[model samples]
Target: MSRIWIERLAVVLAVVALAGCATSKEKLLTHDDRTMLDIWNQETGGPAGSGRASRELLDARQALRRPLTDTDVQTAPGVQTRYTRTAQNEIYRQFHRLPNPDLVMYVFPHLTGTDPVPVPGYSTVFPLYQRVQYALPGERVEDY
Candidate 1:
């Protein structure tokens, strides 16, 4: 067959397919004004057995259901008990600060810079580590 004839045939086939789809969609959309209850009644047999199947199904479901106790609902995953954060755990649970004891240092009296003047000493406290350390997710970190 010629290329032109093939193109015309393809266009005709497309048009026929589109027409078929439109008719089918129209038939599906055109339904009688029946309420949901009427449709449900027809599905289970007839209007005489309306709500009988629904009641039986609900009763069976209720028999399977059980009462939930206090243990059913739990707090956050890692928490065994609930309490206010006081010391190290005060920080976010994800990045817990590792224990680092504070070091007390005393600066002795010394000469002033650029001048021959005497300066009194003072005491200061700083963490043992220069930077605050954090424990990893699964690492064992003691909470006191």
Candidate 2:
């Protein structure tokens, strides 16, 4: 009886370990394209081809779930009145329909004065998020 219990526990542990190892590869891939498409479609309907983009977005969103910090702004207050007029030029460069770039944060590598190291993990990429106004479902961008 004790042997049977031990075998079951061992099987469960092995399954958990395999699951963790299996997911490591997915973490390295870039799925942000889907996320961007989903947000764009949900806000503005473009074409029927965007369905795949929405699925990718859902996957990415699920993967990035984490506890929010105070500094993180889910929705920018006064996103239009404050940024729409002044950021018009900037918005034109970043997006076509909406000037707000808040859905996805752009991450770039930190520039160091030292020579670039070719080793595996010596530096990090920084996140740069552009704040954009979002509208609810079936709502127009101007409504925000």
Candidate 3:
């Protein structure tokens, strides 16, 4: 009887531990991960794998040219817009145009220390939201 009880408890604990290790599908992106664009083709399929190595290169170039500031982020209609206009523009101009319309742009305000004066900087990454089919062309197209 005691052995049976111990076995049940062990099984329950094992299940809990496994559950804790599981990560949601939504939370899958990691730092070293290749972008969605790199994995897909123009056909709108899953993970075709590898193309246009310089896509983010353009975005980086654009960011380097622009003054990355907190004010710039606040003034823009939204986060995505700021990236597309300022950072992405520079990237597009400097290198090949970004084919993915739904590209995600990230802007992070960081500091030297854990909590020092927030030194402003920006980064852009492709987001799944951009991949969603739009009703019409252009940003804020659904507003109409």
Candidate 4:
């Protein structure tokens, strides 16, 4: 009886596998796949039965073709008067710190005392300004 049950289970599994493989290979269009007319109708709030939508779109396009007037350009939401320069900002701009100049020095060969150990010649470099110092905007030329 157990052997008969095992054979029946195997046959059922094989049938299920074969059924899964029997699906059609054709591709299906999803709900999001829309035709151009569908998209146009959706965007324009439905078909322009009397061609009013097309006429309005054409009128808008033609209006865009004309050069923008000064008033139209200036009236944009992003167009605003420049903010008044704050005293702190002005001071910060005037006192902007400049990069310090570097100076390189080469030491000649020398000997140490006590044990008379010989020292080899070497070069050392250091910045001219060790601390931060601000200068007037036009006071110094930064052409280092």
- Candidate lDDT scores, in order, read 0.75, 0.58, 0.60, 0.76
Candidate 1 Cα RMSD (Å): 16.2
Tell me how candidate 2 scores on lDDT. Answer: 0.58
lDDT (tens digit, per residue) of candidate 3 on 88-144: 566643232233444557667767886687868776766554444433223332222
Predicted candidate 2 versus true structure: per-residue lDDT over 1-144, tens digit per residue:
999999999999999989878865567875565777677667765545456666777789999998767655545554544445456645543232344433344444454548864443244443343454544423443422
Tens-place lDDT digits, model 1, residues 104-128: 9999998987877998998999989
Q: What C-alpha lDDT, on a 0 to 100 scale, does residue 129 get in candidate 3?
A: 49
Q: How far out, in Å, is residue 6 in model 4? A: 99
Q: Rank the candidates by TM-score, best first.
A: 1, 4, 2, 3
Q: Rank the candidates by lDDT, best first.
A: 4, 1, 3, 2
14-111 per-residue lDDT for model 4 (tens digits): 99999898876563434567888999898886788547787887789998897879888977644332223667656545455777888999999999
Q: How many backbone clashes does candidate 2 have?
A: 3
Q: For model 1, which pairs clash? A: none
Pairing residues by index, what is the TM-score of model 1?
0.33
TM-score of each: 0.33, 0.20, 0.19, 0.30
The residue-level lDDT of candidate 3 at 96 comes to: 26
